[model samples]
Target: MIKHELAKLVEIAAREAQSKDLIPPTALPEVSVERPQNPEHGDYASTMALKLARAARMNPMVIASAIVSSFPPIPGVEDITVVAPGFINFRLTDNWLREQVPVILGAGASYGSLDIGKGQRVQIEFVSANPTGPLHVGNGRGAMLGNALANILAAAGYSVEKEYYVNDAGSQIEVFSNSLHARYLQALGKDVAFPESGYGGQYMIEVGQELATEYGEKYLDQPSQLGAIGLERMLDMIRVDLANLGVVFDSWFRESSIYKEGKYQAIMDLLKEKGYVAEREGALWFTSTSLGDDKDNVLVRTTGVPTYFAADAAYHYDKLAERGFDRAINIWGADHLGHVSRLKAALTGMGIDHQRLNVIIMQLVTLKRGAEAVRLSKRTGDIITLREVLEEVGADACRFFFLSRSADSQMDFDLELAKQQSNENPVYYVQYAHARIASILDLAKDRDIDFSDGDVSLLATEAELELIRQMILLPEVIEMSAHNLEPHHLPHYAQELAAAFHSFYTVCRVVSEDIPMTKARLKLVQATKIGLARTLALMGMTVPESM
Candidate 1:
């Protein structure tokens, strides 16, 4: 919000300078206001003058000075100066920074909320991992990423829905069904051999045994019935695993439903009508090359079976047109990277804005025990399950570490480090800051120090002001994260905020004999607690009051 306000101020100053004939009457460019990396430069800096220098044919310093001279006085701005290399810097008053303590305290849990979205509808589909297998640590990355992004969008005032798209009608499901049936026959002591293309995870055997124990020979004559039972069991397992990782989808959209409801056929007809579909060698193609794709993609194979691309196009149409979400965000794994462009082209062929669909490709996650890489589950002999990681560390640590890196970057999850209880663990370190604040607040309460009317103006120490500075960045951080669709920023920002609080606590006494100073410091810590807790909550991590 401060950055926006400062950017507006710079625009106004530039226009005013233009009117005064101090600069050429060129059209105003987009203004950018960013924080100076160096502390001494100022709180916020702008390069509008430097950007205009080329067009105005004037020295950048002269332009900066002219703009600063014409800059209107805005509250909370302590000083505006023109630095070398044509940068206009604006510093916030320390009094204004300290004044935000009461504001943050007053806002409570809603401190970082912004209205940037204005209640637009957004549906985020993530971790739609096939029900054929258990979710591994890799799927956990996309799960946390989508959940956290939904939180950020909601905090920014968007109506958000988390969805899990069930690929229940695909080739993978058919294979899984065959595998389950084979195992079910084996469970009945039949001489059926396992399908070569069958799933090899031990969970499949358990499902088979459970099916045999539950329904016996009734399903031995019915492979479809056995497959349906196994599919339901696998979905139940996936749901429990996601719940353990702190992710719950608001909707479970079954891919089979589209065909059952005739939406899939409807989409195919629409694409054909739009001239985006063509028949080639008994196969139906999407003709994506018309939309600038390097090659055409198949909508249906020569075997008359529709491809996954065709099903996804129908699903997206349902999401944006029938369901009427303003935006649809899909969080997929790296393997689905090839689907991104074709899906967008499909949307375009459907008379929808391709920009409305955003697909984020989350890279792989490698689980480690100290320095050694651990890939397979000790129990299932498959990729290590997210449930196993959650059981070992916790939902909180899993969410924190899964969201620590950008979705585009591969990350190694250190199991031994996550299990640590000390400050060496980031989630522990951040939560400890909140716990420390709680103890300080308890100390104030025990001493009968009434901070209800704490004077924020008395908070002038560098540590106090620095802590306040970090506390107020929450709104900016939320806005930036929402704008960029990057939830990774929240975890990093939480760590920085916690570090600022720890630094403040080490140098300043909160329950000192000086009642006035103690009251002010207590209020500061209380504000920090609110901000730190909110950040952790947004990242889907638990904030411990005492640890």
Candidate 2:
């Protein structure tokens, strides 16, 4: 990765300082390498001089100049300069940037793979929507975030698993079942009153109507098992909705199974043994306050029924302790913000490192058609279902818009923009670049011109070199995104890569007057195609050869 390479350069500077006795030779400070926000500054910048000046008791510029002057030559590095405020900047030469074309072509799909995670196991749990009804468009945001993170982590050499925790045994399922039963009775011309807490979605009514037709009046008196039947059907529907959104779970873990398999009791016993459990007001409480929580949380009610927190504690225990995963991540909606500190405390109380658990809260999403805001589903009349939106635009477009903003910020998705085939639609714009490149190469093949042995060193135009620079940053982008657990950067990076390719096409002719130049430019175009394809695949979207 470029960041790692830059760190090595800084280490060289540090060693030079040590050998000259500019600083203490016996001790060296940890080095931090970062990219400059302004491109004119340099490719990469380091501020170790400013950090070390006070300790060395010397002028910042003197320390910075010493480090820059003593640094040995690095390949592809044009010059190392000390800038204002004692910042060291490194710029790559044009030759080095041009030489990356063959490196990109040689690596192909594996261009951005890194070994940062060092093969540690990570589990990403997301979109675990209660299997009581169809998934809403709100749920789609979490799916896109989690799936993309999984792909990024795997590329960074982490053993990652994508999972969905099914809340099948929750109270929502009970209400959903009773609603279905009442609807079934109402459809059969019975005079039963609908329960106040029943699910009033059109989908639930349709399911009840189907049951009425399948076994007419058979479940009228004894509809006790209707909840189980409805839960399974909802689960099947949820699976289809996720697949439509281009997401797949490696495992579907059922919450009900945890209690049946004895893991729930095992966790509870572990907590009680550790003296983290106590009775308060006739209910068993977890001593979360002892670990910095606002108050204690109830593990079991006075009626002896386990709470969701109990199941959640057991689920996390199974993930880190039983399954032996090094890290666990849960993607939740913004409403779960209050649950973070307690969950962390619970994990620490159980003896596992709480820092290993990460909870990301995704803000809400609102769909807009034009000047008006769209909320209710025209079909369901209550919530906008994920399937409805996916079917309306496309899986590719839906995912692109969902990831356009950071997880912590609210987003307004423009429905009309998503359907547009113009550059206004970001997904369409990126895919068109890939398709345009394919057309150019196809035309080249008709004239018996091959790019496999083209002279890549001849690519010297500013556009060509800029495109090459952007292409080489894919590996660096992946490393940064994975390290920070943020995916909003991918969509932005894809647009930049696509724009670079488009700018290059407009300025440099690939099949022009100079045959050798044409051949060299073709190789550069081919490298661009590989970079675009790899990015689209990483986002779990289709790589359309012709859009």
Candidate 3:
């Protein structure tokens, strides 16, 4: 809403300048209204004058003064000042900001929901970890990021579908199946050499035991032939593990199913129709270089099996065309960074709009226990599971920690810090603030106070205003997070809002002997609770009424 107001101001100034013949009609510079990093620069600042000065070939100060004089008084603007270097600053009325308290409370949970997405269908596919073992720490980061992004997009008015792409057709599944069979043979006291590339995690032993219990010694005699059935059973166990970790997939898209249903061949046919495929080296190759890939890619090997790229290309085609999604976002780990250009090339070569595909590469996460790092290797059965981390720090803290950092940056998961009972942990700090407000509100309710009839104007302290400002800007923050496809901003914004609320609680007396101010303070407190609750709810976390 503030951005809209600022855009209006810029347009008015641009028209006024054009009318005065100071600049040509078509030479009006693009104006940007940005919040200043420093509060002293006023609520919003525009550099239109500096931009127009270059085209007008005049002094920036003169242009700035002219624009300021031509500007009409806005209702919420306390004052408009022209600063040096042709920057026009606008200060907002404190009273107008304070009046937003009731508006926010009136909107309730729906206050921050915006229509920026315009009802476009968006599919966010993330944490599609191979159904081989329990989800490790690396997979948890993607899960939290994807789930939070989905919630943020929905709040910003997107028709969101959360999906998980299962790698049920890959060689990885063979390895998992062989591993289970080996574990079973070992459990039966048979002399069997474990496959060199097989998984060796202890969880596979459980899968083997479960298989033995279900069908005792039936599949063991036919190791090679039983792989298909064993793979299916192993995937079932993996699904159960993921559900236990609070990671649910709306669609478990099977890679093999895509190929089996002829979607893979259809995609190849479309690419050939678009003249993007060619035969080379006794294998079918995709000419991805034309679309900005580093080189051409192999779509099918000499063995006649389609490569992973072929399956992904077909999967994306189905997602975009047949599924009719307006956008598709893939949350991938850091190792997949090199695949971005190739995937984009594949989409482009297939005549699909490249803009429809958005790949977010989340940097790797390193988990530490105190000063020592936790080493994880699935082959050696030496990895930390997400379940273990969740058990240690808690789901709320684990989600908060993972969601707090940007996906582009590597994050250190400090087990010791997360497990601490002190305020050093950000999750506890924010939850404590919510609990503190609830405590105060409970106290007020017990005193038979009627806070519904309070005068919000009594909340005149700087800290109170700061808190109100944060609460009013909740929608804007959500909009930013959604547009950028980044949920890290949510936790950071929550912490800032909590800080403001805590400062207000410390300085403002909510249950004073003076009844008028006390009622007003109670109203402010209730509004804060509404905001904190909504903030936590946005991240899919519940605000405990009592902490």
lDDT of each: 0.89, 0.86, 0.82
Instruction: Report the number of clashing residue pairs per model.
Output: 0, 0, 0
lDDT of 2 by residue, 120-190 (tens): 99999999988878887778999999999999999999999999999977666777778889988988888
Among residues 3 or more apart in sequence or in different chains, the pairs in candidate 1 whose N, CA or C atoms overlap within 3 Å are none
**Candidate 1 regions off by >4 Å?**
367-381, 414-423
What residue runs in model 2 are displaced by over 4 Å at the alpha carbon? 23-29, 222-224, 367-381, 414-423
* Better candidate number, 1 or 3, judged by TM-score: 1
The worst-scoring run of ten residues by lDDT in candidate 1 lies at 375-384
- What TM-score fits each model? 0.95, 0.94, 0.93
Question: In candidate 2, where is summed lDDT lowest over 10 consecutive residues?
Answer: 375-384
Q: Which structure among the candidates has the greatest lDDT?
A: 1
lDDT by residue for model 3 over 240-271, one digit each (tens)?
65565455677878898897899998998899
Clashing pairs in 2: none
